[model samples]
Target chain A: MSVLEIKNISKSFGTLDVIKDISFSVEKGQVVSVIGPSGSGKSTLLRCATMLEKVDSGYIAYGDNIMVSNDAAGRAKYSDKATLNKIKLSTGLIFQNFNLFPHLSVLRNITEAPVCVLKKDKNEARQTALELLDKMGLSDKADSYPCQLSGGQQQRVSIARALALDPEILFFDEPTSALDPELTGEILKVIRTLAEDNMTMVIVTHEMAFARDVSDHVIFMDGGYIVEQGEPNEIINNPSSERMRTFLKRIIEK
Target chain B: MDYSELLKVTGILLQYLLPTLKIFGYTLAFSIPLGMVVAMLKMCRFKPVSWITNIYILIMRGTPLMLQIITIYYAIPMIQTGGSDFFGGLFSGFDTRSDTYQFTALLIAFVLNYAAYFAEIFRGGIEAIAKGQHEAAFTLGFTKTQTFFRIILPQVVKRVLPASSNEVITLVKDTSLANVIAYAEIFRKAKEQMVFYSSLAPLFIAGVFYFVMNAVLTVVFNFIEKKLDYYQ
Candidate 1:
């Protein structure tokens, strides 16, 4: 089953063509990792798929609900408010900087959306939040604020926050890019656990080795288009394109 | 100054304390919320609305408060002509001819003037929040209103505390400017008593009242800051 389908999507920031007619689909419980150099439109593609940015001309659907599609005039028109909201409720996005609400405690941060947005019972939400925290190994830091926690711990809390909503799909924009090399492993490990639990996810990442190890599929994007994409081992190990060879060589040298 | 004279002076000045604080309390009560409205208006995306708010802020902040108070009290009546039934009916309830009109005029000027300053401070606090906070909240399915009140406002309150305290303290001292309109607040009473007693001691006693009020404010603001320290 296709969890998300983005077809013929193109986006531009003013005159700069950031994403040019990119298309992809994520299957149920499949982890798709998008790997590319800087300014390759990977982030923009993720943003467009997540509805943070609108495509110039394309279609995006979550399950069978179309969130955005073209009109007769060729302008992108979003779904009506109620349907758009339903689509939003079904997906989650985690940022690189771990944009946790600083004024809230770890427990409140996780439970807030569940109680407020989903209208879950207060006790039920708190119980779920406690369980998520325990799973994240942050049970002891429930009362602590984001500023009080280290970067890795904050990212874990953010992941827990996303899970509390029970979204069908989670999108990550460099989940571990902002952390120290030593701290990156913990976030990757958490994502690996989710993958093992058969969670559907689309990740734009720079961790080449982790992509090869954990991702079911790898997408290589450069200059606003997918240069190549296939099974993780096939894409990462056997380079068929000149640009992919140079890109991998540069990273390996670094 | 003799001890008995000191006590007598203190007694007289204390009688005017409530009236002085009335101006401070009322101005604060009205201005804080009005300032929030003004801040939103100033930040409106519509160019004309924000431009008008900008000019209002400019006029309030550029002119002296004393001039504004005097204009509100005196110039309003002078500007109203008998044939202008519209203006006459608008201010008909407010008899600018009455001696008590000074209090109303003083309040109008103080609120408008102080609200502008508070508006600017609030605008700064709102803008200081990082863009990522809004994005994170949006991704979590929070509406714009929910994101502002639930996520942004509490943090804004903490960030604006110190600057707001400074304005509040200034308002305490600015209340003495009411003496210019002969409203007979504490400082004006102290001045009259000084002349009567042939001593400067009454003036110094007036200082005591202001200092004590500001001291209490300092303590309250400090306590609030300490409470917010747990987060930052």
Candidate 2:
């Protein structure tokens, strides 16, 4: 089943049509990566799918739930906040900036959603957080603050935080874009591990090689449009569109 | 210079300390929560609410606290009784002109003034929190209220502490304004005793009281800041 389905979604910020009538979906266990130049709206698309940014017009569904649909007035309307809470539970998001709560310790960051939102027992949450921290190789730093960690570690902790909620589909908005080149590998490795476990994910990224390596499908976007999309090997290895050909050539050379 | 005279000065200042602390405690008790409410109102999505709170903050911050205390304490009684004795007739036995009423008015003014400064400080702390924090918390399925109380408020308290510590220190000293209406707080009592007994020791004793109280508060606030220093 499609874990997430978005159709005919259109969004604009102050007359700039950042996302112009885009549509896509991610099925269960599928890994999709969206690659685009700056201002191409890949992050905006990921945000819209995750419900962080309201869609100006379209349909977005998660499993059996339709999160957003047009109202009688032809304006996009979302399910009530109560229902959104349920939809939000099924999705998790990772940002390029790592967005961890600076005031919270590493342990608290991972357990907060589980305990506060999921209403899980504190002990169980801590146990789950410990296991995730161990998985991220951050068990030793569990008591450390986000500000104290390197960019790489903070992003890993954020990934752990997202996983703690046990979302059906996780979204990454250029998760490695903010890190040093050396640190990007650490974050990408974490995402690759998730993919190996068959966790469904939609990632917006600029790291073309990482996308080709980890994603089941790769989409090339430019000027707020998906220029080409296919299996990672086919799309990255051979491109049909002139724009995709030049774009891939330029990034590969750089 | 004698021990008995020193002890005598200490006793008189100590007796007035309770009233001084009474005003300080009440002002903080009322102002802290009121300040939070006002900061929320000032930052709320509604236009009118922010506007009203903005004007209120402006007026309170713009004016001197002593002026506000005098206006509230002196002006209200005249306004209440000057009209028709309507209030006087209604509550025949009670006097709005009494020392008790003046202290009440002083408290009201102090709360209003301090709440404004605190509201600004709180607003600064809250706004300083990165937008990403809220998004992350909400994306975790935490409700807005949960995000605020659990995720946002604690961080804000940490950020606002140094600023609030200054406000708090100033509040201790500003409590002396209570004497403008002759509420007989420690400073006022010291001044009265200085003239009545023809000795300056009461003034020195009052200074000691202010210093000791402020010293205790500084240590408490520093302790709180250190506890929060676990994070950046």
Candidate 3:
């Protein structure tokens, strides 16, 4: 079964339509990269899919559990709270700003949801948290506060926090866009490792080479719709549309 | 300034510390939590709860606490009894026969008045948290209750510490106002000593008591502010 299915999703803020009739699905263990310029609805699409923002009209299903479906009257209807909670427990999202709880130490940030929300044993959660921190190359910084870490380090800790929940699918919304130019490499490398592990994931990003190297399928979005989608080599190296060509040229030239 | 007289004044003033500290302790124990509840009500989306709490806050803040003390201690009892047993019957079962009823009235006055100030401080702290924190907690599958107590309130306490400290020092001094109801806190004892001895030394010694109390609180609050300074 596909890990995620979003059908005919539409969203808007006031009069500005952010996402327009977008549909896509992520098969289990498949890596999909959403590449688009600013205001191309890449982040909005990710937000809607992750339930951060409600869609105006659509059906969203995660692993055969329908999260939201359009009713007979065409209004979005959400499932019961128990089902939604179950769905959320199986998904994780990493934000651009890192959004680490400022007052909590790094170890607490990673172990909090596991111990509190997932009801894992405290010592067991701490043990697993240490493992994830070691994977993120941040084991030494366990007790440090978020503000004490560099932007790159903080973003990596956020990734560990998301992964500590054992999510079935992960979403990254421009994870590296907020980092310094020199600091983006470490985050991209970490994401590459996750892809190597065959994690089912979707990433909205601006790094052309990183997307081409890490994703199984590439999606190019513009004006709230998919402009093109295909294997990474064909779409990244040989674009068929003028808009995709222009957008890719602008990123590749720089 | 006889040495023996000075020591005697200090000794007498120290003995009155219990009632003064009692007022401070009881009011803080009740008002801090009461203020939190009222602040939540004010912030809740219900129009009627917010409106009613607004009126309560406005009335409490708009008037002098001294007036409130007098009204609660004196006027309420009068209104409860003056219209004969028909009206006074409501307060018949009210525990007025105890010697501590007057002190309870004073406590009630302090709690209601100080709770209004604390509610605003708490509301400001609560609203100042960024929206991202709530979103992060929710997406992590935390219930609304867990999100608030675990993720939200610790940050609020950190932010509101300095303002809360100022109010706390003011409360140390505000405890003197309990003398209005003739409850005989430390200040009242000092006033009696002044009249009895025909000297202002008791009053000066009382000033020392207040200064010492305020200074001690300043140090404790500074320590707290430093402790919570681990966050931004």
Cα TM-score per model = 0.97, 0.94, 0.94
Top candidate on lDDT is: 1
Model 1 lDDT tens row, B1-232: 7999899889988999998999999899999899989999999999999999999999999999888888887766765655378876677677776776888889999999999999999999999999999988988899999999999989999998999999999999999999988998899999998999899999999999999999999999999999999886
CAPRI rating of model 3? medium
What lDDT tens digits, residue by residue, belong to model 3 across residues B1-232? 5889778877888998999999999999999999999999999898999999999999999998889998988855785768577777766655655798888889989999989999999999999999889888877888989999999999999988899988888998988898888887889999988987889999999998999999999999889889988866
Candidate 2 C-alpha lDDT tens digits along A1-254: 68988888888899898887777778899999998778888988988888888988989999988899888876799988777888898899999898899888999999988998888999999999999999999999999999999999999999999999899999999998899999999999999999999999999988888888889989888887788888998998898899888888888888
Candidate 2 residue lDDT tens string, B7-90: 887888788889989989999999999999999999999999999999999999999999999887766656566656676465
Worst window of 10 by summed lDDT in candidate 2 chain B: B88-97
lDDT of 3 by residue, A123-205 (tens): 99999999999999999999999999999999999999999999999999999989999999999989989988888999999
lDDT of 1 by residue, A4-72 (tens): 998888899999999988888999999999999999999888888777887888889998899999999
- i-RMSD of model 3 (Å, 1 decimal): 0.9
Could you give the CAPRI-style class of model 1? high
> Going through the candidates in order, what is the number of backbone clashes in each?
0, 0, 0
What's the best-to-worst order under lDDT?
A: 1, 3, 2
DockQ of each candidate's interface versus the true one?
0.80, 0.80, 0.68
TM-score of 2: 0.94
- Candidate 3, which segments miss by more than 4 Å at Cα? A249-254, B82-93
Going through the candidates in order, the fraction of native interface contacts each one reproduces equals 0.76, 0.95, 0.63
